[model samples]
Target: MITLQLAWRNLWRHRRRTWLTASAIAFATTLLVFMITLQLGAYDMMIDTSLRVFTGQLQVQRQGYHAKPQMRATVPDAQALAARLRAASGLDGVAARAQGFALASSVSRSYGVPVIGVEPEFEARVSTLPHLIKQGRYLSSDQAQEAVLGAALARNLKLQIGDELTLLGSGKDGSIAATIVPVVGIFESGNPELDRHLVQLPLKTFQEVFTMGDDAHAIVVSGPSHEAIPQTQATVAAQLAPGSGLVVLDWEQLIPGLRQLIQADMVQNWITYIALILIVTLSIMNTFLMSVLERTREFGIMLALGSSPWRIGVIVLLESVYLTLLGLGIGLLLGGGIAVYLHYEGFTFPGMAEIYAQFGLPGVIHPKLSFAGFTLGPAVIFVFTVLAALYPALRIRKLQPVEAIHAV
Candidate 1:
């Protein structure tokens, strides 16, 4: 306790210098916490949006359908398979969809588009599409001749709600299929490709138009949260027969591109963290070394009065501990305050939605202020600060009393 008191007094004796060093550590900690929190938050949003936009947590597709995605390569009796999957344990929702590419034409313009047919009520439970309606209304199960267009698609085609558009595509049986449907909704998917080239129609109408009978290209399944995905996938896999020709895939398998992007972000964040530790280590070393040099004569006096060299060294380390603790306190308070504000208010980057959309990320980013981010930065600072004090403390032990006292 006496040694601690001496160390504490020593730290405050040079209040301006001590505080300045503390401030540098504090600023670095704040930046580390904020940047890491933002990266984590952005990753969370990307995973969620990518999953909810279309893929869900898992999907049941015909063996080659995902790779080829042709009308002929579909799950036979898809409605029955969907029903069986829906009754499985740990699954939250199941939506069967028949998807294809078609050319959409209006009186004044034409554009090639990707089209998907879904059962409105079932799809609503599995996808975010129903909630993304920008103009007009979402599709209804009873509306067989109605379709929804992506916002950009509608604009390019010069179509609007209640406007008629003609679609032309190849049917499942190798026959030409054509139909005209009224636009019921326009949605902004926050994905550039989807918003520019996707369309939605009623599942029954899609099957009829494509001459697919009761087949669907994919059945998307979801759980209440990400934690339930593995269990839900295992249950679905076990339910399938040996020769079913159906395969279940998790989000990571379905969206490898987005997964790879997150991995890259993690690597970059780690590099930044290592750099922060190096910077803090150097700063603490410089400050504590200067203090040791300036107090050499005092240390010499203590040595001459029979103070132990080890005890004097310990006091130097304690001073560093004090600085580190003070800096951690200040940094956490500041970083946590900003994190909370970002968590609630969110940060919007205008004109970046399209750029982020290319990678399937959302424009608005909301940082999550969790315990991990709150503690990690300060913990690293504390460790490096102690390490930084070691050299100065050892120097105190090697000091010769006569030489140190007579030094200028």
Candidate 2:
């Protein structure tokens, strides 16, 4: 306790230098906290936007369907399975979906695309497509032979609302499948895969046309948010009967390359953070070195009076500890407050609202302040600060009392 007091008093002797160094530390920490938390929030938004547009947060499918999607591989009794999963997962949004590849034809043009089947009312719980309709309306019944087409696909086939579109494909039973449905609606999802190649029909219509026998290829799921999906997915997976030949896939698995993209961006962020911390570390090191040089005679006099050289070195290190703790404490209070505000109130970029509207995403981005975000920055700074003090503290070991005392 006495040593700690001595170190604290020493800091005040060079009050201006200490304040400047501490201010630098606080500023750097604040920036790190805000940027890292903001970055995490942006990632959450990106995943939510991409999933809600069509893929959903989780999907239950045949074990091998995702690896090699064949029209014949399917989950039997889709609505019943969806109900069971919904009850077990405690998720509000669970919809059975059927999919098949077909060639769509209009009077003058034709294109090959994936045809999906959805339950109209249940689909709205899991998808934003019903809300993205730019023309006409979404399917109103489970058995409607009407279809909704993507904007790009409609343009490719020269199709418009109320136009008769014909679908041709091989059903699950290896028989010829044919259907003609009126285009009731068209959607622009802002996702190329969805916009360019997706076609939707009532689940019943798809089953009948695709010979799927009341079964669906996938069961779509939506949780309250992306963060809650893992728990929901685990609950759903556990409730499935053993050897059910089914698997639950989360957003990371459903969306290709998304995790890799986030990880790559995080690496870039850490690199920038490291560079900033290095600058702060160098500044603190300069302070410690100057303080040691200015107090050389005092240290020498103490040594001559029977104080060990190691004790003087210990004091220098303790001074570093005191300064670091002070700076870290103030930095965390300011930075953490900023992060908390962002997490709650959210923030909007100047013109992002319009862009969000175009993409059907929420206008504001909320930062997710996690434990990692809270500690990672401060921890790194503390470690670097200790390392910086080492150099100046070690110089005391090489000092000779007579030489140090007579030095100008």
**Candidate with maximal TM-score:** 2
The stretch of ten residues in a row with the least summed lDDT in candidate 2 is 223-232
lDDT of 2 at 219: 92
Candidates' C-alpha lDDT: 0.85, 0.89
Per-residue C-alpha lDDT of model 1 across residues 1-408, encoded as one tens digit per residue: 868999999999888988999998889888878877877788878788778887788888888777777777788888788888888754547989999878899999988888898989888878887788889998888347999988899999999999998999888898987899999999987777888998998988998988889888888997556667788888888878889888998888888998899999888888878797788889889999999999999999988988888999999999999999888888888888888899898877778767766444666788867777788778878888999999999998889999888767
- Tens-place lDDT digits, model 2, residues 1-408: 756777789999978888888888888888887787788888988888778878888898999899899987798898899988888777779999999989999999888889999999889989898999999999999999899999999999899999999999999999988999999999998887888899999999999998999889999998666567778888888877889899999888887788889899999989999999999999989999999999999889988998888988888999988888888888888888999997899878899889888889888888778997777888889899988998999999999999889867
Candidate 2: misplaced stretches above 4 Å?
305-310
> How high is each candidate's TM-score?
0.76, 0.94
Shift of residue 351 alpha carbon in model 2, Å: 1.3
- Scored by lDDT, the top model is 2
Q: How many residue pairs clash in each candidate?
A: 0, 0
For candidate 1, what is the lDDT?
Answer: 0.85
